[model samples]
Target: MIENNRIKYSLAGFFMGVAELIPGISGATVAVIFKIYPNLMTILSKLRIKHLSFSLSSLSKKFQFDLLLPLIFSMIAAIILCSKAINFLLNNYEENFLTFLGCLMIILSLQIINFFKGILHQKKLFIFIFLGTSIGFILGQLDVESENISIFYLILSGVLAFSFFLIPGISGSSMLVVLGIYSPIIGAIANFNFDILIPFALGCLISLLLLPRLILSIYSSYEQSLLYLFSGLIASSGLLLL
Candidate 1:
């Protein structure tokens, strides 16, 4: 039997939190890469909010709360602690950062393309690529200048970000950036502003609780097409970054 280690949980949570901070980096991808995503998802899938006491009792029977609590707390702490540093880098070196991000995005997209294993014919790929380019160009051109957003928008941003959190190649932070709330959200974290964090965190929690099962259901039905579509999106996001 493996001995329980709080240190391991702390490290896992820290890395996952770091992954969450980076635009185009998914916490789910980090977990999957680290070989913990399957079990983590299995655990999350079993969580129920039907009743606080009953849920806790049932969860205690199947999951290690001591181990999980540390990981969860650590991730939250890391996200809060790291936000200031990430904000600094993004604010000061945005051009260079975008360049690096663009390259990384292209590389990730290429990996997905290969994952298809010659499944996408040249003609189909051309079409998807064209569509991707068009969508990316449009999104890139759109001005996200408004920083004075409402709480509802922040929650919505959280929903969108967390919805993409499960998709291996998708980055929730990148989505937040695209939505123009990334800077403000990070600022809120750094300044300890709960007004925005409350709604945003709620959205994330809700999505984390609900979205994975839906995504799995969808993937079960359209795995190949979904992969192709996501590949195109990743390719486009890379173009937009440049």
Candidate 2:
């Protein structure tokens, strides 16, 4: 029984990683499809010192973090491994790439719409959407100026990406595109250029370490606000493709 479960967990991780590699697909969506979204989010949001210790002890006896940990790590690895190939395809096949991006963005927009339906009537909701849209548009227009990878920018990217990871319908890859690091960063990884990837990896590690605790605090006290902010971010990100 335990062995079967481990196989399933690994398979889930592989698929989730593939989904995450695609520009518009959400890792959370993959988790949802695999019937692990709620559990994953719960673990992510509630992770802290006490919970970590408990989870670690549980893992010593059994494959506790089995599915979630493998899934996340695999997804990250896949993204790094696949970045160059994806970029090559995108560059060589502009029409196909744009079409794929268009479809993905449309699906993402629908997801955002569904999310907003629950709070559509809120007086400030439109304002949030507008803000998100404006920001997304502006970000899309910004040019990538720096080719050199820096620790500060890498950390900033990780913080932004990690924050978006908690929100439904947001794509971390799309966030990378907006920040102008998507192509170069992916290229660095695809070619095994650690000079560029190392700092980004470090930033991602720090963000992952800190994110769970931050999520717990927000979920405990400011669920509504956090949801609004996330929704806005998603909406804006979707608008960027337009």
Per-residue lDDT tens digits of candidate 1, residues 83-127? 788778789998888788778767766675574565555446555
- Regions more than 4 Å wrong, model 1: 1-16, 28-43, 50-97, 113-116, 120-141, 145-147
For candidate 1, report its TM-score.
0.66
Clashing pairs in 2: none
**Model 2 RMSD, rounded to 1 decimal:** 5.0
Error of 2 at 100 (Å): 4.7
- Whole-model lDDT for model 2 versus the true structure? 0.61
